[model samples]
Target: MQHLLGLYRASERDIALILQEAAVLKPALLSSPPQSFSFLNGKTVVLAFFENSTRTRTSFELAVRRLGGSILNFSAATSSLQKGETLLDTIANIEAMQVDAFVIRHGESGAAEIVAKHTRKVVINAGDGMHEHPTQALLDMFTLHETFGRLSGLHILILGDILHSRVARSNIFGLRKMRASVSVCAPPTLLPVGIEHFGVKVFADISQALEQCDAAIVLRLQLEREAAGFIPTLREYNTFFALTDEALSKVSHKIFVLHPGPVNREIELSSVVTDRDDTSGKSESLILRQVTNGVAVRMAVLKVLLYDRA
Candidate 1:
């Protein structure tokens, strides 16, 4: 694959290769002995993020550094995009500098694809509007498989703004490809039209969704949706969709919770689950593990993209 624009086009073998590479690298790179990598040696990767980010950008940077690559963080706010320079023109200018690859995050859907078409370098979509976050889904899948030892036959419920979450969309594409059952729960307004066409059941009630799924991937409310009046209020949204302490207390089975955060505490998830992330293998939250796995998955992705092999 010349570019990882979304999971919708990634072959099942491609996904497995990345996950398997990450499984091997995670322990080796994160261990006490800290086995290092040089897959990115003598290569320069550009972080061209048009939107604000925390985990994705940080983890990608750490992943590149760990692989001995040089970093160039490009901010759209400070770049010529502010002065009416077209997106393609700006990307062309950057491409002319001989960068090896681009990690792009943009508020516009298909932005990465456009950049890829204009540039000769490999493009990894960190995120693209509400379309997809491929690496996030890869890392999320790695976390799920690492914890459960398998993804087949496991029911994973994605709870929250499916209409606006790139992470949720990517996860749906990836999990379904891996033969895992997927479902989504959200307020009527927060759910997109024909989302059921994605081959996942849609539930208006969170409790019903939780009851059927083995793991819940809770998503944060898109603040943009609230401003556009997608829902009645935060309190009302929380009442229907929030994974609160009281909500999970009723489920008898062992179910885990994951979030691609900046979590809205007491909203998407309560403090009880978010605050008690532990290493005892008993904490319901796999939030931090997702963050840690992000780096390894990104490293594996770079290895594959740059070297064309895992």
Candidate 2:
């Protein structure tokens, strides 16, 4: 198989096969964890993050370690990247280190594709601007697979910041590829042009989008867009797009809530819903499960792309 650059770029059969593999591997990874990786054990994975992230960075690091591989961290502030070293030159130096994988996050669109073209090592798109967050979509599909037992015909609603959310773009592709129906719920300003072309239904109102959906993935309102002139104010966006408990109550009982991390509580999601444990009080929230599944799904990705002898 070729490198997985975007979820929608994958064939339907391939997506189904990965989903099936994830189902079988999730229990194995969670129970009898591998001491390290069988194939990646001595391999070095480079984490080149040019943007801010807590979940994607930490999850990738944990996934590498759990697979028995090591990582070399690279941040722009402490590296030659700050001194104007080109992305190509940096990747070349890292490639010379015999790295096995390059998990990259950059603020520019198509940055990962550029690195994929220039580098000899495997390139995983952690995120590249508003272009795509392929792994996030993978983990989300994992989470849904775990919770719902299937992907085809599932109704998923993605809420907020669609104009600048790599998550939305990737999920649109990932979900559609898996034969799921997808909808984007956001204010007009927060949505990008030509969203319908991606094969997702669009909703200008959050309440309408939530109606009878199987799951809802809420995206935090990206403040950076304000500077980029994509949006005007947090106050207005919150008033319109924020997913309060009140908003969640409007959705069907079967609809599960999901969010990618650094959740702006009361901004993108209600703390009451996201922060709450189940009846046990000690049980983990779905957000925590999302994080946990991130590692396993990434491990599956690494194993399939880097190790599978097929």
Candidate 3:
């Protein structure tokens, strides 16, 4: 439970404990003047992000501050990386300054693992290039647990740009570890090779994938990394892959919808379906819940990795 490189590194027991801790911490966070935990009172954590981010970076900063830990924001642009210092050398320089943990998001895959190998401090992978976003998966799992009350026997549909989504990879690992059935729906170009070997049924049609599913997680299309001719057009992709109000109507039973943030207006999910919610106003409009739970889940990870639980 030291460095969270990916969901594949975690056992089912480990996942359960992190989820339990997150559930316990979340209520305290929702308090009127949110209660401070201060578990990492004297520790220093460095947020080393080499990629642009909004939610994940902010959530981790809030998580650390809420727990009374000191954070040094590492900006790749302003740092000595521009001065030709090697990644490991830059990290070594930072480690020499008495940091306790490194929360990193890098454009390079295996960047966190490289840091983990070189540093004594804890390394929590915020994300790595098309590799894994482990905390996002944990928070998504927490959100799903809140909705379904259990992951076992639930058939979850992961819809959209699977080939480029680290979130998809992480979710697949976490969901399957908990005994939930997962199915992926994407355009033939968007679906990764050997994805079926991950124990998920792949579908070329979204409607067919949603038929027996209890919940759906719509993924944002990674247009930035996409090559020319990979997708014919945004209009064509939306016509088939977008989770719309019309699509949800086809499901016989009520089901929840989730999206990891920065959603394209009409690409991955439609506005109507995103706004729709259950009586408790929790199920369908779970994007904010996923964001909120992110802080709690990250808190649990930081506490577990940095503190002694004897």
lDDT of every model, 2 decimals: 0.89, 0.79, 0.88
Distance from true position, residue 89, model 3, in Å? 0.4
- Reference-based TM-score, model 3: 0.96
State the displacement of the C-alpha of residue 192, model 1, in Å, after optimal TM-score superposition: 1.0
Say what the RMSD of model 2 is: 2.9
- Please state the error at residue 69 of candidate 2 in Å: 1.7
Per-residue lDDT value at 218 in model 1: 91
- Supply the global lDDT for candidate 2: 0.79
Q: On a 0 to 1 TM-score scale, where does candidate 2 land against the true structure?
A: 0.90
Question: Which residue pairs collide, candidate 1?
Answer: none
| Candidate 3 colliding pairs | none
Highest-TM-score candidate = 3
Q: Write the per-residue lDDT of candidate 3 for residues 24-59, one digit (tens) a residue.
A: 889989999998877899999999999999999999
Native-to-model Cα distance after best TM-score fit, residue 205 in candidate 1, in Å:
1.6
Model 2 stretches astray by more than 4 angstroms: 32-35, 224-233, 277-285
